[model samples]
Every structure is written in C-alpha cells, then in structure tokens.
Target: MSVTDILRLGPVMPVLVIDAVEHAVPLARALVAGGVRVLEVTLRTPVAFDAVRAIRAAVPDAVVGVGTLTRPDDVAAARAAGAAFGVSPGAYPALLAAAAQAGLPLLPGTMTPSDVMTVRAAGYTACKLFPAAQAGGVGMLKAMHGPFPDQLFCPTGGIDAASAPGFLALPNVACVGGSWLAPKALVQAGDWPAITALAQAASALRA
Candidate 1:
C-alpha cells in the first residue's frame, strides 16, 4: 500500500515500543478491536522484530510497520520481518535507497523546510513531522501548507489526545501518530481493555 493509504487507515497511528514479544499480538488485537489498525512498532528493543513477526502472523487485520529506522540494514531487517512499511526520524540518502530496493513504503521524517525539500526532491509527497511540538506544531504545518500545498503529513512526537484534534484540523494533516494510546503502565499491566478504550477514543478523532 502507499504511504497515504496507510495514513488513511485510521485517525491515529499508535507509536508503539513493545518491550516484550508476548505483548505484541494482544496489543495489536486490542488496537484493532478498537478500530485502530495501523500500528508502528519502533525498533528500539531487542525483541522488536520478533514482535513484528508475531503481530503479522496473528493479527491479519492490522497493518503492521516498523519505526526508528536509521540504517540500510534496518530497512532490510524490517522488510525481512514482514513490516508493511517503515518510519524514520529523518530522511537519508542511503536509507531511502535501501527502502526503494526492499520495496518497502516509508514515511520519512522532516523537521524543517530543507528537510521537506530533500524528501520532495526524492519524490516523496507524504512525510512525518517528527518531534512535531518542538518543530512548531500546528503553526509549522500551516507555514508548510503555504509553500508545499501538495505535501501531506503525519505529524508525530509530543502529541496527545488533547492536542491531536488541533493537528488533525489542519488541511495538510492526513492523520497523527501518538504514544499515549498504549502507555507504558497500561502495557506493563497487560491492561488490554484500557488500551482498547484509549484506542477507541483515538479512533474517533476527526481530521
């Protein structure tokens, strides 16, 4: 699927950091149960690939992806693990090449006009505004809209339920990425029901 198609799968894409491989399927099931199917599992832990494989095998309805991709090998590994897509904190030439080579769709991150231009030059119109709050949040998106009206964004980082609506309200935003839907405490407690509730609330947000 295209990057835009993935972004359109739900109102909010949960930025998950699954520490335990065992939590992967249950967490994915919870999110899917609540109408949130686009899951981005960050490669920040040892068992991340395993978690991805588990979720892919168990949750057919969920569109599983890998995040925190920084290297060419990361792209290969994510593709091997059956990630439908990949996300990075920043766009790089090698990473872009590797993603293209692996036939993996990527939502590369951008924090400035230059960064946007770089990705745009590489033929990407959809991108992630990483560290969104620190990069001026809604105001930055507005400014970007004026120059790159055709560009679409999935603004991530420092966003929560309270502020997601404002970001979604923007004409340029296709959706948002958030970590609050699966908080560490809830995940650690194995509170799938609570996570499902959070996902339900997030899924209801409108653009």
Candidate 2:
C-alpha cells in the first residue's frame, strides 16, 4: 500500500524502540487492541530485527515498519526482517533510490525545503519532518505547504499530544509520528495495558 494509505489506517503510529525481541508480540497486540495498526520499529537496538520478525510473525494484522534507517543496508536489513516500510532520519539520493529498489515504502526525513525538493524529485510526495519542533513546527509545515501543497508529511520528534494536533490539523499532514504512547519504561516493563491506554488517548487526539 501507499504511505498515505498506511498513515490513514490509524491516527497514531507508534514509533517503537525495541530493546527486547520478546516484548514485540504483546506490545503489538496491545496497540492493535487500542485501534492502532501501523507501527514503526526503530533500528536503534541490537535486537531490532528480531523484534520486527517477532511482531510480524505474531501479529497477523499489524502493519509493521522500520525507523532510524540511515544506509542502503538499513533498508535491506529492515526488509529482510519483514518490515512493510522504512523511515529514515534524513534523505539522501542513494538511500532513497535504494529504498525504492528494495520495494520498501519509505518515509524519508526532511528538515528543509531543499530536502523536500530532492525527495520529491525522487518521486516521493510523502515525507517526515524530523525534529518537528526544532525545525519550526507547524509554521514550517505551513511554509512548505505554500509551494508544495500536494506533498504529505508525518512530522516526528518533539511532538507530544499537545503539539501533535496542530500538525495533524494541517492540510498537508498525513499523520503524526510520536513516542508518547510507547514510553521506554512502559515498554521495557512489559506494561502493554498502559501502552494500549496511551494509544487510545492519542488516537482520540485527531485533527
């Protein structure tokens, strides 16, 4: 499916940092129960691939993806682990080309108009606004929309429930990625119920 379709599948896409592979299944199950279907398993830990595999194998309906992708190998690695998509912190020509060649629906990160231009030139109309707050937040997104209203973005970083709504309310925003629902301590402690509740609350925070 397209990136926009995946974003529209749910209001909140949990950006997970899986340190333990064993927690993948339960965590995915909880998010699904709370009405979330798309998840981004960031490649930040040694067991990241294992967690992706576990989530894919155990949760039949979860639309699992990978995040923190920096290199071409990162896209390949995530694909091998069964990720449906891959998210990068920033955009690069080789990396974007590799992702398209690897058949990974990539949401490349961008922090400026030029970055967006490059990604758009590569046939990607959707992107992620990394460090959303520091990059000037909704105002930045609005500025971008003036020139490229067709482009869709999922702003990540420094985005909590409070600021998320403003981004989502924008016409150019497809969705918003955040860590508010899957706190590190909660995930590490195996507190799926709390995470599910958090996801529910976030889902309700629609634009």
Candidate 3:
C-alpha cells in the first residue's frame, strides 16, 4: 500500500528506535495487535537498518517506514534495508530528488508556511511538521490549512498520547508522530505489554 494510506490509517504512528534487532518483531506485533499498522523506525541507532529488516521479515502486515533521514545517502541506506517509506526531520532538495528516484514515498519536514509552500511547489502534497510542539503545535498547522488546504501533515516531535488527539483533530493533520508509545526506557526493558497498552490507548484517539 502507499505511504499516505498507511499513515492515515491511525491517529498516531509509533516513532521507534530499536537498539536491539530482536525487539523489532515483537514490538511490531504488539503495535499491530493494539490497532497500529504503520511504524516509523528512526535511524538513530547503529542497528536501525537491521531492526527494519527484521521487522519486515517477521511482520508481513506491518507498514514500516524509515525516519531521522537527514542526508540523501540516508534515504538510500534505508531503501537498501527494505523501508517501505522514509521521513526526514527537515527538507533538502537533493534528498527529495533521491527519494523520488528510488520510488520511496517521503515525508519531508516543514516548520513554517514558506517551508510548506516550497514543498508544495516541489509537487509534495504531504509533509512532516518536526518538533511539533516547539514549532507551534496544532495552531501552526491550522494556520497553514487556509492557504494550503491540499497539503497533509504528520506532526512529529514532543507529541505524546495525551496531546495526540488534538493534533489529529486538525483538518490538515493526517496523523501524529511520537516516541511516547515506545518509550526508550520501556523498549530497552523489552516491555512489549506496556508498549501494546500504549498503542491501544493512542489508537483510541479520534481525528
């Protein structure tokens, strides 16, 4: 399925960073069991690609995407590791072009209306709002909707289960990206049950 379809399926997309490859499958299974299918595994660790590969190998139903993409080669590396899609904290023309060339659906980050307009001009109908809270949260996204109704957003950074529903309620917000559900401490502890509960709670949010 397409990245947009996958992302729009839920109110929140679990932003995960798997330090141990073994946790990938169980974590994915837990999320899926709790009503989440789309997962963004950020390349913040050395085993990120292996984790992505392991998740894909084990969970055929999960729609996995790569995050923390900053360079063009990062995109290439993710595709090589079998990412279904890619997300960047910020936009770069070379990275965008490379993503298109690789046929990898991308969610480039934008912080302002001008950033939004720039991506729109580049033919991207959807984008990511990084550091969502610090970047103005739902209010900032709402402000842009009037001028760019066609654009969709996946607001990332500082979002948690408590604040997710509000952002998802915005007309422009497709889904929220957050690491709260898969907290580093919990994941490090191999607390799949806790993650599952978090996912279930997050999935209860309405757009």
Candidate 4:
C-alpha cells in the first residue's frame, strides 16, 4: 500500500520499540484487537527484524512496518523481513534515493519547509514531522500548510495521548505516531490487556 493509505489505516500508529522478539505477536495482536492495525517496529533493537518477521507471520491483520531506517540496505532488509512500509527519522540524500529505488513505500521525516520541498521533489507527497513538539508542534504544521497545501504528514516524537488530538486536528496531518500505547514497562510485564486499553483510546482519537 501507499504511505498515505498506510497512515490512513487508523488515527494513531503505535511506534514500537520491541526488546524481545517473542513479544511481537502478542503485542501486534493486542494493538489490532484495540482497533489499531498500523504498527511501526523501530529498528532500534537487535531483534527488530525478527520481530517484524514474526509479527508479519502471526498477525495478518496488522500492517507491520520498519522505522528508524537510515541506510540503503535497511530498506532491503525490511522488505525481506516482510515489512509493508518503512519510516525514517530524517531524510538524507542517499537514504531518500535508496528508498525511492528500493520499492518500499517510505514516510521520510521533515523538520522544515525545505526538507518537505526536497522530499516532494523526490516525488513524496507524504512525510513524517519528526520531533514535532520541539519543532513547534501544531504551530509549525499550521505555518507549513500555507506553502505545502498538498503535503500530508504523520507527526511523531514527543507526542503523547494528551497532545495527539491537537496534532491530529491539523489539516495537514493524516495521523500521529505514538509510543505511549505500548510502554516498555507494560510490554516487559506482558500486560497485553493494559496495552490494549491504551491502543483502544488512541485509536478513538479524531483526526
């Protein structure tokens, strides 16, 4: 699916940083049960690829993806792991070029108008507004709408359940990415029910 379509899958996409590969299936199933199907498995852990592969194998309803991608090979690796899409923390020339040629639908990050324009020039209409809170949160998105009216965004970083609605309310935002739904403590404790409740609330957010 396209990046936009992936973002449109739900109101909130859980930004997962799974430490254990075994938690992948149960975690994905919990999130899906709570009505959030778009799951981003960040490549920040050693088991990330295995987590993605396991989730893809076990959770057919969840659209599993790779995040924190920074290299050309990462794209291929994620695709090989059965990731349906990919997300990068920031867009670099080489990484952007690689993603374009890698056949993986990517949501590259943008922190300014220039970054957005550059990615747009590379044929990306959708992007992630990384470090969104530090970058001015809703205000930045409002200003960006003036010049990049057609561009859509999925705001990530420094966002929680309390502030997600504000970002989602922006016209340019397709959705928001958050990690609050699947906290490390809860995941470590194997509290799938608690995680599911968080996912349910986040999924009910209005965009």
Candidate 5:
C-alpha cells in the first residue's frame, strides 16, 4: 500500500520502541486487537529489524513499518526484512532518491513549508512533521494548510493522548504518531491489556 493509504488505515500510528525481540509479536497483537493496525516500530534498538520480522511473521493483521531510517541502506534492509513502509525523522536527498527508486513507501519528515515543498517536489504528497509539539503543533499545521492544502501529514514527537485530539482535528493531518499507546513501562511489564486499552483510546480519536 502507499504511505497515504497506510496513514489512512488508522487515526493514530503508535511510534514504538521495542527493546526486546521477544516482545514484538505480543505487542503487535495487542495494538491490532485494540483497533490500530498501522504500527511504526522505530529502529532505535539493536533488535529492531528482528522485531520487524518477528511481528510480520506473528501478526497477520498488523501493518508493520520501520522508523528512524537515516541511510539509503536502511531502506533496502527494511524492505528485505518485510517492512510494509518506512518513516524517518527528517529527509535527505540521497535517502529520498533511494527510497523512491526502491519502491518503498516512505513518509519523510517535514517541519516547515519549505521542507514540505521540497518533499513534494520529489513527488511525495505525504510527510511526517517531526517534533510536532515543539514545531508549533496545531498552529503550525494550521498555517501550512493555507499554503499547502494538498499536503498530507502525520505529526510525530512529544505528542500524547491529551494533545492528540487537537492534532487529529486538523484537516491537513492524516494521523499522529505517538509512543503513548505502548509505553516502555507497559511493554516491559508485558501488559497487553493495558496497551490495548490505550490503543483503543487512540483509535477513537478519529476526528
């Protein structure tokens, strides 16, 4: 599926950080069970790729993708590991070119109109707004909407349940990426039910 389609599949995509490879399957299952199917597992841990492969094998319903992609090889590696799509905190010329040619759906990051335009010029209509809260949150998105009406965004970084509703209420936002659905404490404790509950709440924020 295209990046836009993946974004549209759910209202919120959990920005996950899995520390253990063994936690992959159960965690994905809990999120999917709670009504969220789109999952972005950030490559911040050593077991990231293994976790991606594990989730793909264990969870049929979850759409697992790789995040924190900073290099061209990361794209190829993620595709080989069966990532449905890829996300990065920011964009680079070579990285964008490689992902485009690799046919990997990528949501490169953007925090300003110029960044959005640059990604758009490279033929991407959807992008992620990194550090969304610090980048002016809803107001920044609102301002950009006037100029880039066709742009689609998934704002990530420092967003929580309380602030998510405001972000999702915006017309330019497709969804918001957050880590609250599967907090490190919850994941480490193996609290699937609690995670599912959080996912349910986030999924309900579809405005």
Candidate 6:
C-alpha cells in the first residue's frame, strides 16, 4: 500500500518495540483482533528484523512496517525482512536516496517547516511529525496546515490514548503513532486481551 493508504488503515498505529521475537506474531494478532491492521515495529532491539519476519510470516492481516530507520542499509534490510513500509525519525539525504533506490514506501519524520519542505521536495505529501509534543503538538500541526495544506501527517512521540483524539481531530492529521496500545507491562506479561482492548479504543478514536 502507499504510505497514505497505510496511514488511513487506522486512527492509531502502535509504535512497537519488541524485545523478544517470540512475541511478534501474537502481538500482531492481538492488535489486528482489535481492528488495527497497520503496525510500526521500531528497530530498537537486536531481534527487530526477526520480529518483523515472524509477523510477516504469521500475520497475513497485519501490514507490518519498520520504524526508527536511521541508516541507508536499514531501508534495504526492512524490505528484505518483509516490511510493507518504513518510517524514519528524521529525513536525511542518504536515507531518502536509499529508500528511493530500494523502492520502499517511507513515512519520513519531520519537526520543522524546513523538514517538511525537504520531504515534499523528495515527492512525499505524507510524513511523520517526530517528537510531536515537543514540536508543539496540535499547535505546530495547525500552523503547518496554512503553509502545507496538501500535506498530511502521522504525529508520533509523546502521544497517548488521552491525547490521541485531539491529534486525530486535526484535518491535517491522517493518524497518530503511539505505544500506549501495547504497553510494555502488558506485552511482557502476555496480556494480549488488554492490548486488544487498547487497540479497540484507539481504533475508535477517529470514527
């Protein structure tokens, strides 16, 4: 799917950090059970690629994506691991080039107007607002809509269930990225039902 189509899959895309590859499939299943199909598994752990592979192999309904992409190699690696898309914390020359070369759909992150411009020049109308709260949250997005009316954002970082509706309410926001849906305590304890409940609530945030 295109990045825009992926963002429209659900109101909240869980930003997952999987430490154990074993939990990947079940975690993906739980989220999909709650009506969330787009998942962003961050490349913060040693088993990240393995987790992505496991999810892709086991979960046909989940559109698994790789997040926290910082290197040129990560783009190729993510595509090889079966990621449907990729997200980066920031947009850079090399990473952007690598994504184009590999033909990977990317949601490059941005925090400033200049970053948005750079991403736009690279042929992306959809992007992520990294560190959303620190970047002024709703206010920043509102300000940006005037200058970048054609752009849409998936604001990640420092967002939670309580604040997600506010972000989703914005016309410029396609969705929001957060970790609250798969709390570490819940995941570590194998509490898939609770995660599913969280996902259900998050999935309702937009509609």
Better of 2 and 4 by lDDT: 4
Q: What TM-score does prediction 5 earn?
A: 0.98
Clashes of each: 0, 0, 0, 0, 0, 0
lDDT score for residue 201 of model 4:
93
Model 4, 29-133: lDDT tens per residue? Answer: 999999999999999999999999999888899999999998889998988998999999889888888877878999999999999998999999999999899
lDDT of 3 by residue, 1-207 (tens): 566676788989889988888889999998988888899999898999999999899998888999999999998999998999999988868988988898888888999888887777778888999889999998998888888998999999988878888898888888999988888888788888998898889888962
Q: Clash pairs of candidate 2?
A: none
Which pairs of residues have clashing backbones in candidate 5? none
What is the lDDT of every predicted structure here?
0.96, 0.90, 0.88, 0.93, 0.94, 0.96
What does each candidate score in C-alpha RMSD?
Answer: 0.7, 1.0, 1.2, 0.8, 0.8, 0.5
**How many backbone collisions does model 4 have?**
0
Candidate 3, residue 112: the lDDT equals 87
Per-residue CA lDDT of model 6 for 73-166, tens digit only, reads 9999999998999999999989999999998999999999999999999999999999999999999999999999999999999999999989
Clashing pairs in 3: none
Q: Residue-wise lDDT of candidate 1 within 53-130, one digit each (tens)? A: 999999999999999999999999999999999999999899889999999999999999999999999889999999
List the candidate 5 regions with Cα displacement exceeding 4 Å. Answer: none
Once model 3 is optimally superposed onto the true structure by TM-score, how far is the C-alpha of residue 203 displaced, in angstroms? 1.1
Give a tens-digit lDDT track for model 2, residues 20-41. 8888899999999888889999
After superposition, the stretches of candidate 1 with alpha carbons farther than 4 Å from their true spots are none
Name the runs in model 6 displaced over 4 angstroms: none
The Cα error of candidate 4 at residue 69, in Å, is 0.4
Model 6 lDDT vs. the true structure?
0.96
lDDT of 5 by residue, 110-196 (tens): 988889988999999999999899999999999999999999999999899999999999999999999999989999999999999
